[model samples]
Target: MPSDNVYPSSNGPSQVDDTIPIAQGQRTLFEFGSFDHSKIPLEPEEWPVIIIGSSMVGMTLGVLLGYHGIKSVSFDRHPSTAIHPRAALFLLRSVEIFRQLGLEDELRSESASNFDLDAGMIIVEKLVGGKVLASMQESDPAEVAKASPSRRLWLTQNMFEPLLRKRAKEFGAAQEFSETVVHYEELSDGVLVVVQNVQSKSYRKVKTKYLVSCDGNRSATRRKEGIEWQGPGVLGESISINFKADLTPYLGTRAKHGVTYISNPAIDAGFRLESGGKAGFMIVTRAGDKKSFSPDSVSERDAKRYFKEASGIEDDIDIKVDSISYWSVAAFNAERFMSANGRVFIAGDAAHVMPPTGGMGGNTGIQDVHNLAWKLAYVLREKASAALLRTYDAERRPVAGLLMRQAYSRLQKRVFRTVPDEPELPDIVCEIGYRYPSAAAAHIQNPNGDQYEDPHAPLVLPGSRLPHVLLSRDGSQISTLDLIKTNFVLLTTGQSSPWIEAAKGMTLEIDSYSINTDTGTVRDSEGTFSHICRISEGEAILVRPDGFIAWRGEWRKDGHRDELQKALERTLYLSGSKQL
Candidate 1:
């Protein structure tokens, strides 16, 4: 555990404007919430994507876009990385996104693997008492293997952000800390963002082709765009206290668990153990009797008392208090995910906010950027149509909507004690099974017989994620996903010679309800590509750049080439456009 009495030494804010000329009145920079961005870089690069909020969502988007060859500038008002452990749970889908970015091993190394496979859940009478309530040990290892190649984790945002920040910078992202975005205007072809240096009272404007809002709960970007948020109002408030204490004696043999839900009905609290079992923990407690418990209002004596009670350790324990924060367990999402022009978009807490119990907020935001970045890169490279941009809102909004619902359900049972275990199933579903209803689904033929249904099963659908399966080529083993590493591919059967010829000069495919075959080299040795998929032997699936099946086609006895070309042209928006 990091020193309880000592916080990390200042590492300074990231370079905001590298070689940006100070225009007269805009040169003022005042101390803001965190660090001051007085340091400037040597070269001023024109960013293609302007991302507000340098938290998990924004940083993830910045890195994803940057890695895909899009330059972006990300800014946050916080002086440094998150000092507190806010968002901790990492879903498998989020891991998949990082895996594609070549960050799988690095993340897994620091992940919380205590208890079971880092996927276990525990309920207890109290932290100090360590009395078991109803606990679900880790899932079967076989079931875990089926879940994903990238596993779920219990790492905190404070730890996660630094990795994302470094990767984003390495991938050509310009990041600024302690600089807050004040205003932004969506132009006809792009967006103009105005940000202020809180400390210096200085400001600057950044122009980019697109703007992504990852600004978190009180998103000014969402509010400024006149986007309406529709959902249930606030359920209640809780005090999230970040403190340090030796819980070895308290946890005893139970220290393996990452989260312990305190069933001490009186306080209605939950204790989250940070990566190391030593000290750091954030105790979420119901705002006592009064309306809300503001950290400022609580004296050290009272804070210590509440912390002890929440820990179920009323016995005197030397607890070093760090930072205290408060949060509302409300579930809501923007009625609209993007501006009228699609030049601006919202993700993360800006798009939807829910109780942190399910840890869907950060993961959903990561997926949001994953879905949008590739499209933005394709459009910028002229490989896709501008109309394709609309799919961001079309696809991600519903997933966020579902996640928000799941979060609330978890809060109902975990916090309010009103709902049942329904929250459990949705948590799994939202993490990996939520489907998209965008252009990808619209153009693809649902081989499952019904394209409109969202069974939430592990099968691959047009708009859903492609199924994971191991494959072999030239005696080297690889996952089926490796085929679509950075480009769209056409996966078909060896018998479908016509389909092969159809893809002679075009690409549209990958699928679960897929019609794939074990050809000479492309073999689904695990029966994944053959027996498990819904496709026939003489069909082909068109996968997009994001590994989504854009469309599937059956061999036309007359000829499949002409139809294949048209669908490829339509999906890529390359009908009359020149390829870059």
Candidate 2:
């Protein structure tokens, strides 16, 4: 139905400019054409991948693909990066993905604030001189460090997207704005897309081997593909008022509190501080019997009055209402993440939408593309079979379903103060401990095990993330997670020549590192590697490019090469048994 408005040549006179503006921060790494001044040639441009959105998720995918030497182009209807601070929290796993993409330091440096070790939620009748109702604490830093080398980030999406966009451009990924993907047709070999410029209404054709839609919840591509969402579509609605005010003086002893739930006769709202507690946003819900608030009806005066009531601040306090926005609190996951033909994939909010109570919406989307980008890179490079793409749906959709339930439950309890049937997993468990089924890893993973295990006492099982452990590589301290980035890793303990030999025989580049305290390859001086990972001498764990454990067992020289080869073949779908 979306393709019915195709702007074919017969639709109107051709006002084409024979040129298109260069994308923001774009660098000419791939020789796209012979046209002068880096302009379009008015012909169908073929790309390895064409992403339909250039927001956080789309830019992340582009950066990941470009890091793999895969060329991609991203198009978004917006003229630039996000203007509002959409998502404010990035979980540990999402931070880990950014770290893996070499953005950890930069992100932290640019973040408005980091969650303090003592950060938690405070409920009060008023911000100043009010009785506290309850206090809820987040996880401990020491506990989080045991599971991941990277910490959770509190940077807003508006600030974070530019970093990702710059990193993506550094890797030669192009990001075009003010362009919309009007229609697309999936072919046997690739996907043909019709892109229209917002200003000129001119159309251009792009042929990409794969099409990824990150176009938010109201995705045109998903609608065109006839993929429907399944879950509680809308739970509630509220208006978010983003403003600048130094509320630290009013917070007093609870200044370090990350979130403050304000409950009063005049207003019921939630306050989240940012910019080092100098700026923040308040989610204002309707007080009992109050009129339903709309963005159109709410003026700057109303926003300031709400802020003053929530903060219990004086009338003379300087509070600038920067923006007022409305949002639907919804929870849902798509019926499928991949198209019927498997050439088109949807990631981010397009595949799933959930409430932001737990800050998992954007993080889940970032991890979604982290799981898919490597598979796309491998398939596009012909290193893996097409069947590998099918695992994206099989693997991510279930995780999205679980996360949606978790988010909805959290919203119910936190915002509405009502308990739901969904059982709440621990924070670290929900963040990074969720495991995959054998459907993604083929026969190598446990299909019937629990979806998540205790991250503190990790099982180091297949389909789960490789547990993080502190190690010393050449006298420099590093995490076990630091070894995983671009290539598959074969990690073994003690002197394991057989694992190294097996890696050498593989056609794909697999880096083998033996953690030996004596030989000094990668020293596990504390034995935490053996204790946490549950691995001992002569045993090897095969880690996928995404840092999930694919296979782990004893590697004997008798048949080590054959065993590793079979594991890779089955896990990556190289055996040609499950081809689409």
| Tens digit of per-residue lDDT, candidate 1, span 420-491 | 434355445667667666464445544554222322344554675665666777778666656665566666
TM-score of 2: 0.89
- Per-residue lDDT tens digits for candidate 2, residues 292-358, read 4532456677777788787877758888776766666778899999899999999999899998878
User: Which segments of model 2 are wrong by more than 4 Å?
Assistant: 1-44, 112-118, 290-295, 445-448, 555-557, 576-580
TM-scores for all candidates: the values are: 0.85, 0.89
The Cα local distance difference test for each model comes to 0.67, 0.78
The deviation in Å at residue 419 for candidate 2 is: 1.5
Model 2 residue 252 lDDT score: 63
Residue 456 error, candidate 1, Å: 8.8
